[model samples]
Target: MWWSKSKVSSISSPLPCLCLLWLIVPACEAQQQDLGALLTAKCNSWNTKTTLSFPGDGSFANVTERWTVFAPPMYSAAISPATEEDVVKTVKLAAKYNISFLATGAGHGYGTTLGKLQNGLDIDLSQFKSISVNQSAGTVTVGGGVRMRDVIDAVFKAGFEIQTGSCSCPGFVGATIGAGVGRWSGIFGLIIDALVSVRLVTADGRIVQVSKTSNPDLFWAIRGAGANFGIITSATYRLHKIVAGANGGGQVMNADILVPANMSAAYFNALQSFSGKMPANLAAVSIVRYDADAGAAGILANWDYMGSEADGRRAMAPILALNPPVVSISTVPWNKLFATAGFGIDPVLCENNVIRDLYSANVRNLSASTMQAAFNKMGTFYSDHPEARGSVLELETFPNQAATSVPDGETAYPWRDALGNMIFLFSWDASTNSATSTAATKLGRQLRDDFVKTSGYPDLSVYVSYAHGDEKIEQIYGRNKLPRLAALKKSWDPRNVFAYNNALPTKYP
Candidate 1:
């Protein structure tokens, strides 16, 4: 029963080997040829100004290198739509062939669930960048493909401001639909709260406008669960007048301080005390990282105040008293804050072809005991995996008055009561061996679990944008609202064509 390779080779005939090869090789070739023919036909049938990129085409490389490179999907083909009608036609064609598809704009989404989409059509919406500002009405209508930087530039030109994510690369529409959290959210509101209406192309290839008065049920679902309903072609949001300074234009005060490893514990205590009574106009975040080369851990605190330098100093007094090693503070124009604050506008931070595991947890308060345990665990993790020296833990205690102002049942976003959002970011080079990546991922998961247990919060809700793709639907959206979201999924996306990113099934388990 146990024959060696020598014995098998002694009895092998050339005809048998040739027969085995003939059976497998032609089948694979036929499948590839059929897919090529199908993609060719689809490209020829498009009625709008669209471009198609196939698997081996030169343009395919750029289309696929949008975000995290870990387990990137091997899409059959990509189509770039120039207009809203182009999106409608592509969706209809994909439906005709029963081919699942995903619409991508900036392609900056972090959810790992996107890797589940295999050999599907990619509907690239990056070409629909258009911005229109209604000065009299105090509103702005932006195309789906517009980025945060584009929105800020256009609104600032007209003496207006809108709530947007800290990063400038994410699509504005995509961020708003997922309950956008921004630096100005404490003053204005969450981005979703400012949404007036959205123009969407549904699964049935129909273009419809959704708002409170029109399609009220669908409107309620789209605010937080927008990705599951349809592809948004464009959106309109209410804008506010820029917070003008005493002289004339608006200004913001930015601060960055570095705390040595010895003072990290004291700094954390100060942060907890300050966060409990934070001002509505102030936003703060602390980052902790361990470096193997340096053989030490440090913390960085970044703060921004929407006022003059004097007011900023008064608000940041507690953090300043920590006596950090490095301190940099400056006052700049409202539009220049992103560049000066160094929070956004970094291209290399999110470079293509990098592997990362992002996780989040919501807590009511950061107890001293929990903070110490987190610091110790991070140190141990870094020591165990020297290759992941770039890992970090971010604690954001910004004032979220506008985000928490809405009632829980009013929107699909369920984490309205949480005071702080904790993010665990583990990143490493993709070329590392598989064992290293696997160990880093395991360590990240363990740290999150330990932190949640130590925090003593029974509600384990997480931010949707920071999810790791393994959490249940109830964990992201609360248990009380899962049935309703499931019902909406059944009514709108009955076939579940757009079930790629943090998918919600058509029926509840």
Candidate 2:
């Protein structure tokens, strides 16, 4: 049995922001502090409920609870760690108590693997938000908790940039640690490719620095298996100068109405043709949506060119020729262009909305039909329930620059050399649509299964960060990387103190 306790004083103090550093301790001691007392004593705020209960708070809460969450808490315990020392203490406490813990940045993970902890300490690093640019070294050190927008703003201020997600709220460390991909792939590369180093607190509560030179094995693992290995405190990324006056077409193409009679075949053919001869300077993503108001279907095609406006026009000719788009293209600065890409989804809410399906390079062609069909079915599903906001199917193609540039064993992210990446995502308010929600989730998995069954696809290679809770350890860590990841886990986290996010098997037991 547990009881709650609270200490109140006449004078109130503001909460601390950004606690850094961490340490570990023996388990027995941590459990001695009455669970209820510990929570009531330290937790300034608390919300005890499922993700379905979170919407009422506008999606923000901070409560001390164990880690198994079927849904995100509408409220987030606002923790701002100002120093590395704070992180160390948190880790030590969690380890000593044998309590699961997870660190979150702008918490935009759509995957349940990130948000669903039954009972554990949630470390919100939002306060550690800071971005510094080193012009001479062409590097940027971003706080682990800093959001993509914060990074962009800082780098743009310093006259340089690196690839980042189109969404603004995702933290740099979490995204890159999870192999972040962005619109500038043709020129730059996936965010993981540019990563130089990371300051991490291992499961054992040891604060260590990892990079190509130090802890190479752990470094490789963190790049892809971020949460599985440790909590990254910050990341250093190699940056490059993005030429100014550079812009591309950011437009929405209505697929259902804009196309001529029965142009699905033509559309596919054109997509294949242009996609086959993808220009290095051009990057595009096609999103299908079901418009309830118009009672028709459509597509939102976002195109990007890293060089000049004129070049963007030339590069976009193939797509523009297909059909007159509803939202015509417009060019803007590379920074402003990315900002317009809509990266700023709220951290807490969107993090709970994550669900991703990964396909290997070999499966790209054979799975197109299954993928398209799934989108069509999902469109119908959403059409029936207007409240379930439209889903986003983003097909991102990686350039040879970063993924290919890095050697296979350089980092743990196995898909570095892959031709492209695709994500099938659908998010809804958990408070409502209980029946349809289950169906939509099942549909999402079915789509993945159908495509994976098709011949010519790469074997099970799921991104650890994007993994579903039901996925096996082998699925999250590819067959080959498993052994190495195991060794790393044993070496750094033998006790399995950090077994929360996409946990790696420490031993047979």
Candidate 3:
């Protein structure tokens, strides 16, 4: 048991935001004051709105849980700071106690390195879910705890559009820390590109504002490698006016196409045809996974167009020429894309605390032969291990003109030229372990290697958020940018407190 406590009523304190830290010890040490008492005793100075919870507490299970059970960070206690001041105090207190701490923003950050954080403290940022839109300023300020769905809904309500992650469950800021991407990124550029400023609490417990003029060095790093430096309390992003489509403002075309395994090659070749000159308003994602009805692995493609129905049809003419077995196209508001018609993972794969072995690479080129080889391998693997059928290989392609408009050196993110982001996601239950998990991981790595041979980039380029955690630091942050990032790391996070998820070295290796 995590904490053994005989029955007791929840404590309702007034000072420092009623903390409920009951770290009850085992029988032998029951009489004497223990960690539980110490934690409770320190609650006097916390804010009245700030709350602390332990295992077995109400809502603790849900708040502390992560989307991927694989390599989840273990936490003995969690704190939900009601204000930015509470955030600073919480950080200082955690550091004082020598407890490892990781801010939980939607808690969807999935990487094996997170497993290194055992017996840590969860700085839950859920209370920071605030959104402020300045019509006069044409900017949107969102709290750290905001999710993609929240941003989408808020922008749509305010008659503005913002770029964010495609997935609804992941935190908007958390995803942005790794460089956010989504349906509208093709036209607006990366989520980081829309960044205006950030309210940050550094590793040293100092609250500071980061923008182009203020803390310029940290601003550059925060756009890409933010998690390595500090906890972001809030971020300001430049908002764009909603463009009109056939139905109304923010309304666009959403298409779903299903291709049998036999035609996977043709589907990919058609995708490659429009690679270099992909339309500015188009975003495409294809998933290779099992289809029980077909009893084989096939391709499920989501084609998003932010323009007129005629224009969308004209743009997708080549792809529609294939005449796949299943196809659905409709006009949807850009904000509610996932809900009405998304990549189809929003409802099925959004469940929290599920084991998912994932691997990824950001490639500049797409190869039809490589796609076919991997598709066939995935099909065979699905047949061999039907229990692991939730696994999928996803390919995301968006326009690069807006992303590439910014010089590579202007920000730490070096993948402005990457055309497609590929992820090898293998999902299964706890019952499928050992040999089954091993095979899934092995296949995931092999697929990445095979794609690397034709990825067109001189070196491996990885989007840190989807990386499987086995990749070298250079592969994720780029080789040439390391020395400089390391220097910035020294100045900002000298103690290396933020060293869990693809952390940068304090000194160049």
Residue range 1-509, candidate 3, lDDT tens digits: 34322222243454342233433334323322232343455444668887767777886787798899887888777788999998898777556555577887899987888888887778999999999999889888989998878888777888888777776888989999788866566678899999999999998889999999999999999878889999999999998887564334687788989899778888989988876878888888888989888999988898888876778888888899999978898987777787755446687757888888899888788788888898999999998888899999988887787888878998888788888888899888788658779899899999999888888987778988887888999998888889999999999988888978889999996
**What CA RMSD would you report for each candidate?**
8.2, 6.9, 4.0
Q: Could you give candidate 2's per-residue lDDT for residues 1-509 as a string of tens digits?
A: 22212222221334431111111113344442233233333332333321111111332353222122345432222234556766776677567555565677766554555454554456767657777899999999988778777777678777776787655666778788777866665567778888899899887778899998998888888877777777788889998765544432222211112332234344445555553446666666555555455564555556666665566667667556766434445545555654454222224223433333222211334244654575566567676656555455555544445456667777677655444455556555546657756766776676667656642446644555555556766666666677887888888888866665677776532
TM match of model 1 to true structure? 0.89
Ranking of all candidate structures by their lDDT, best first: 3, 1, 2
User: Is candidate 1 or 2 superior in lDDT?
Assistant: 1
Candidate number of the best lDDT: 3
Global lDDT of model 3: 0.81
> For candidate 3, what's the RMSD?
4.0
User: With candidate 3 superimposed using the best TM-score fit, by how many Å does residue 84's alpha carbon deviate from the native?
Assistant: 1.1
Candidate 1 lDDT, tens digit per residue, 2-108?
Answer: 22223323543435543533342354232322333333442335545677676667887676566676656557777888878878887886675566678887887
Per-residue error for 12 in candidate 1, Å, reads 46
lDDT of each candidate versus the true structure: 0.74, 0.58, 0.81
For every model shown, the clashing-pair count is 0, 50, 4
Q: Which of candidates 2 and 3 reaches a greater TM-score?
A: 3
